[model samples]
Target chain A: MPGNRWALRYCGNMLSLTIKEVSLALREGKISPLELCRKCLKRIKKTQHLNAYITVTEELALKQAEEAESRLLQGVYQGILDGIPFAVKDNFCTENIRTTCASRMLKDFLPPYNATVVQKLLDQGAVLVGKTNMDEFAMGSGSTDGVFGPVRNPWSYAAPYREQSGGAEDDSEWVITGGSSGGSGAAVTSLTSFLALGSDTGGSTRNPGALCGAVALKPTYGLLSRHGLIPLVNSMDVPGIVTRSTSDAAIVLEVLQGRDLKDSTTVQSPTSHAGFSEDFDVRNLCVGIPKEYHAPGLSQETLAQWSRLADLLEGAGARVREVSLPHTQHSIVCYHVLCCAEVASNMARFDGLEYGHRSTEDSSTDAMYAASRHEGFNAVVRGRILSGNFFLLQQNYERYFLKAQQVRRLIAEDFEHAFSAGVDVLLTPTTLSDAASYSHFIQADNRTRSTQEDVFTQPANLAGLPAVSVPTALSSRGLPIGLQLIGPAFQDGMLLSVAHWIEQRVGFPSISNYEVPNK
Target chain B: MLGIHQIYGRRRVQLNIILPLLCRYYYASRTDNMLSTNVKTLRKTRNTPSRPVTVARLYSSNKHNSKVPKVPTWEPLGEDRIPSLPQVSSDLVDKLERLALVDFRTKEGLVCLERAIRFADHLNMVDTTGVEPMDSVLEHGQLFLRGDTVTEGDCAEKLLPLSNTTVEEYFVAPPGNIPLPRREERASMLKHSEF
Candidate 1:
């Protein structure tokens, strides 16, 4: 077993250890952060085919790990994240490292400033191993649209080489790693990093979490600052955390959550008021399963897992009941319109003039503008920007943009009503099904397919609710099926507590079946 | 080439059924040419009162006007001419060209635009009267304004090198033909010029 294999490599079974356990071990002088860094780096190098990282900051990570090791020796730990190897999505602006967002447009673009979360993690002595790959400009739900190519799911079997075929048999057929945060999820799942940061617009984080079998959190909007997050849809976007366990997500959340002067949209008060505890009692909590979420096209396995989770919750003393969110039917539509409108506005900044890729097709400024945009953005991003601009047109505004915004309010009201009526959290499927094989996924047009995939995840974003996707069971394909727990705004802690409890009950398997010995 | 003709053919059929005016417009403008030439031919074909708006008339126009045509004024097509084709000519492409200053149009651009409209039509079916449009999710919180105090003062020296086209103290950019600096050029210059 991998656990036994890990025991032979380190003092104990390091592969199965959570972030909190690692922290405890570090504090007790059982292991050094340098050793941890070395192990993580070795794993990252070994799994290079996963394409999980856009940029690996080996020098920076080792330097930070060395500092962390000395601090541990001096008995001056910088709290939980100190020396913990982690990664950030490429969209987050790292000070010196290239933050490409997996787009050719900003392939060489380095930020002059760090994102608020990046600075926060650095302050806590977190060792940043790399910047992970993402959908170009966070515009896609499938990871294949990334500039560096698709990140393969770590759980996907890599068939042995076949001499008859003169190639590895079926190795070229990759399983989908769900997008936007696909690389982060893969990194965390494969134990390349203990914690990784992702961003959730609709289902960017949770989609990958379900596919990669990682715990992913999209906290309440504005709780975390967006000062340095490359905006997709600013109102719905939040910095998501991906980790092996819910507690690791919580630990990272606590370290990153705070009021930031840089991001005015951040809540005025600090997140300290909403305290998180993994040990909260689930006895008296009420879990609501929205009826509208049980729509057609949901896989049999996912539905079964959903039912099993509700049964597990009810068996553990939480009241489970069917709740009606009538507006859920209209969520995907509203999400699309609003997302396009905002994306059109936000992307206006990317004209061939400044920091990103400038088209060399020079004739006139106007021609250059068109050429740059056409060349800079992928087909998917260009499609959104064009559609968004169309929706915001004077004649179409009332019919599309304004109407979508009104429906958005209805969506939010549905959540407020459910929460006000005593439901502490909503239980739903994280994705329509398990990870789609690459060949199966590329059949339909990307925009249509992506919209359908966001059906379960978009409503929470439209309503500005905090949601966590926790893996509950493995599909018949040995891929994971995640169940999402969504809570009202500012109740992120309570939402995570329920997720943690479910995680404990399920005992979901990890994909880290390999371990490197500490040097 | 690359199956775009098939997409256009499919779009033309759908446009004919749903929006006859747009179908005539699309037919009158069908060409394996740039957006400018198509727009020019569309303006000429639309202005002619002799031609009956039909699929046959569209094909005939394409056959007869296969030769290079005279350059026409790039007048933005009015809403009436491209009626109800929210995916193709909902003033978004025009605005992107004129206001947003982007001009690139690909063969499948209209197809992608149509997909978004189809998605919006899904939302348009829902009734949402009396519900106030929400800009953000926060209900009770007021805009938290920061004090007008200097935080980290100018760091242009650190920021300018991020862009390769920087001049002595500023980033170099394309010149505006107009007296006022073009919004496009200025933004391109200032994004990396932190000071």
Candidate 2:
């Protein structure tokens, strides 16, 4: 019956409807929740070789869908996401489901309780499709650290092009699916899940979104409950959304945002205002262009693409001003020190004595701690933890850790000052360069290159402000380049609104190379 | 505050121990001619008279050296010599009682900073200055030790009138002569050792 229903709705096998469109179709009797869920599962099965998911719960998903269909028939829809299927980054806890942070540490551990975000989605009748793969402990800037395997760039599957000179040349370079939200990006791009939730401490949400050619929004810190989402840094971490479109991202965010008692960091601020889907007037809005973000080394093509975006906004009657955030240069260093220090402290709880994988060696307590951590953490995570510990050491704490906090305060003040000067949103490139190939990312020089790319995005994270990466143009090489829109803290709705407007003005390429079949 | 004074007193004792050594050596050289002669002879024999005689030699002097009076080396008290009983001040006890009279009275605020630092060092949570970062240590300490008591039952009901009694007698009851669990049965008991 569900197969027949999907066949009818997806006539000609070309149903590219978003989660919102699918929900509306179900409500109007054009399709059923069961039908939509089955189609999503079918798509997942077809793309299984893509290695996007760590675990797929087909049986649990169908059982939940049947319940949702029963509710739909009874006219008792829970909310917008009811019966809509979504995926969560494996770092999030799911009751009775294997919630690995794509590390062997949690390979067999099952959380007894669900993360607050997961519970909220499930309560709204969102069927969980599967847990997507990610960097171990959400540490890497690429998905290569995952235990399952590195998630390949879907854009890499594009067919070779004929050279102007002679023969066909293969252009299938393995693009880096920016991480630690890499799998979330891949899930949406590969159409395995309509939407996915990810935690962004640094640029985990936006980086992957830009790389995978998806719409990602990192909500303002303290706007969403982080009770169950394991933290990298408590002060900076925020739950974000990755989806096919800005509208779908807005829908998922609206459902996920609110004050939770368990998470004391969440505050009742004015930016927590509801109704994000309402019409947004961007004609009179002032968008700031930080001169520092337009530094040298930005690819010529990306700069050209940015100029076009500026012209498009100016044509739409929005004023673009060149603003200065003087403290932007120090944000990368400050973020690394603060985030790594917090990582060192927060991750100390997994001592193998309490939870996670334990070493079988009969060793002393200190040896056990060392063995467990060495066995549990990957290279990137261990490097960061070591770096953080070094900073927090007696000889270096004040010089690095305290100074980093001072710099973080200055960064936040910079944003506050800019906003006070009448800028509604700030625009910058999501990355300094286009997504690098996986091979390039492994080379020694790539570390410096990646850190430089993060220079534009790290300031927003340092300020704990809301930011969204909306793909604006493709590189000359046909790779996607993103334009970031940032807003004041708790102004998630406003940021999303501005992004939605930009999405309308300059349409992004949502379908990457793999999504298009061979002609 | 009392714990602070105790630590300050300990530091003062250490200083006292070092100060008397200098004074005793100086007085011995000035008043005792035979000892001074022996010191000179020893220095001359060693061929390094420019170097000051170390304090270690003072403690190693034999009783047979009649000119040198046998100086007693003071040793700090061992753990067994010091009382193990909990020493709650009357003022603190009365304050706690008065505070408990209020329905929503806050918990005790008396924190031993030295103990806190030791705990932080034990857990390897120290900051760059070789000092325990006070914020996190205080947080973890408050979580672990708040509302905890040395003895069970209400302090007011059990020990209020017995203020003159020593802590060991007033708090700790006599152990009953019950048979202990066998090693086989007690093997699982180790799991509950966390508390």
Candidate 3:
């Protein structure tokens, strides 16, 4: 039996097992679904300072656990994910659950139906743990601006929290979990849940995946249905998966992906991938290092691991070459116009007249619209909505909106050109650096932060390619630094296979490997 | 929109056939065995991308193409030239307030609006000549349209109460006869909003 300290501080050691191990343990009758559910709830309470979860579905989870236990006893359990516990980002709708996108506007909003991905997981018998917090309506990059306070990095466990006696609200002291999907990343890394669903508009999932040392997968647009994911940018938004390993991500992706008639953008013809082989020779792989991803803010540590990982692949007999995506410099700017344009269109739905946050100050319909929007959305959301409309105006339409679309073509073609030149996957750094301290990060406003932070990852979004962030190494500050792998669209399985390869080779300590003493 | 090749590939395959095949694939690549399948490793041929629609960009026929746009006031990672945004005047912001229904009267709102515009202006640096504007990520704007039919119904019971301002089945809204909030009304609304 383990000592009290080891048992008390369960994570980072005891609960480090990935979904595969846990599934086997469950299958062998070594693990109880109810016990696992209770333990996860207990861990969530223990790490309340992290503030990773928005709401814990303890009652629903326990009920589901009982069902899972009964199914196992009857030997009629669903496949691999039968009793697996997972979390969904608050942005995804879970029927009857208060699915706030961490915004006051929808704090009391109960989703009428489950998001496609969430429903698919539940259908496969995966236990729904809770909704992870995110940037309100998934607007900001550094998950700090949400209505619920910023999610602190688990690596910052020793760092003082605001509510704690010695903790101060000084931002510089707290390490920010990279946003939008920051909570999902923190949850998976903290072992609060085995896998969490996140929506990646522009690196929201992968950004935090890097900071929190979890494997993040942003599947190709239309690969996974987006029926009920609260829309941020309709064109670019894709359901993202964060997990302990690339294999865990792949299994979840397989379960959740397919054509849903409700989502018109879903790819109609689903191709069953030829399974990945563990013994597939590295010589068959061709890796391209995008030259443009070496932008100004890239830290030395990130750059070195990026190179070191390439060297590892090369040593394994894979062909590695530096490739160029020249239009990358313009992608972030192009994304702003496109993303905001969609954000404007999507956000127009939040009038107080309909569901969600009606204002009492309704002198006129117009007054109600104005006041409700003002009260409903946070400043970041409102600002984006405003600027998006500005771009859509008749005068600026050609100059900004139309021009940005043309620029998006160049960005997409740049990825296409690189991939067409006999490259299998493009390897790049996910974030410029590891996670940023709150005080240092808040210095730049949200837009500027997203611009620099998403340089490497946004190009993949623009091209509609699949990408995954694999934690490659620890930074000088001992924070996790992840590198990204971008593969061609519709080649989702191949992308995961390559990610799984790097994942095994790097053996970068999983979150549980971090020897942080439990507070 | 799916390009030609993707559209051609995405035909209406029966879900029954797809499901069984999907199951086989899933069982074959179960999480524990996903990376460890010892299949005969064949040299995989690259999937050639067939359809090509030039990425979205403006026409080469524009007169202003001669005078290339330049980013006057922005740089990435916070070396901002000037965030005040003198180009966007108070009058322009007021007009935008009426148009977008967002508050810019506050100092914080003003600064945020300036930051967003200044950041967006960086798009001026890219010379998008001869590029066909990418209208959608899918090729030729391909959306999988199912046969038009009612996907859901009888949801008034579920959706109506979402807004407490509803009167019976009708969501209560201010009368349409009145115009949009005037400047003074907006000021009072802003005060009410406490922004």
Best by TM-score: 3
lDDT winner between candidates 2 and 3:
3
- lDDT ranking of the models: 3, 1, 2
Residue-level lDDT of model 2, residues A403-487, one tens digit each, is 6666676677789899999998888778766677777776643224435656677777777788999876545344667888898
lDDT (C-alpha, whole model) for all candidates: 0.74, 0.63, 0.76
Instruction: For candidate 2, give the lDDT of residue B139.
Output: 25
Best-performing candidate as measured by lDDT: 3
How many angstroms is residue A381 displaced in model 3 relative to the true structure, after the best TM-score fit?
Answer: 0.7
| TM-score for each candidate, following the candidate numbering | 0.81, 0.70, 0.84
Residue A264 in model 1: lDDT: 84
Q: Order the numbered candidates by DockQ, best leading.
A: 3, 1, 2
Tell me the spans in candidate 3 whose CA falls farther than 4 Å from its real position. A1-14, A158-172, A268-275, A515-519, B1-86, B140-142, B193-195
Chain A TM-score per model, please list them: 0.94, 0.93, 0.94
lDDT of 1 by residue, A1-519 (tens): 312222322466564578998888877767678889988898889888889999999998999999998887788988887888889999999998999989877889889989999899999988999999888898777787888988888766421101111233446556778987999988888788988899999999998988888999999888889889999998899999999998888888888877789988888434454467768787889989887787667876676567667766775687887788888877887899999899989988886565787766444565556556666777788778777877887977998899999999998989989999999999988898888877878787778767767878988888888999998765644467899999988888888888988877665656543222111
DockQ of each: 0.13, 0.01, 0.19
| Candidate number achieving the greatest DockQ relative to the actual structure | 3
The better-scoring model by DockQ among 1 and 3 is 3
Query: What is model 2's DockQ versus the real complex?
Result: 0.01
- In Å, residue A391's CA in model 1 sits off its true spot by 0.7
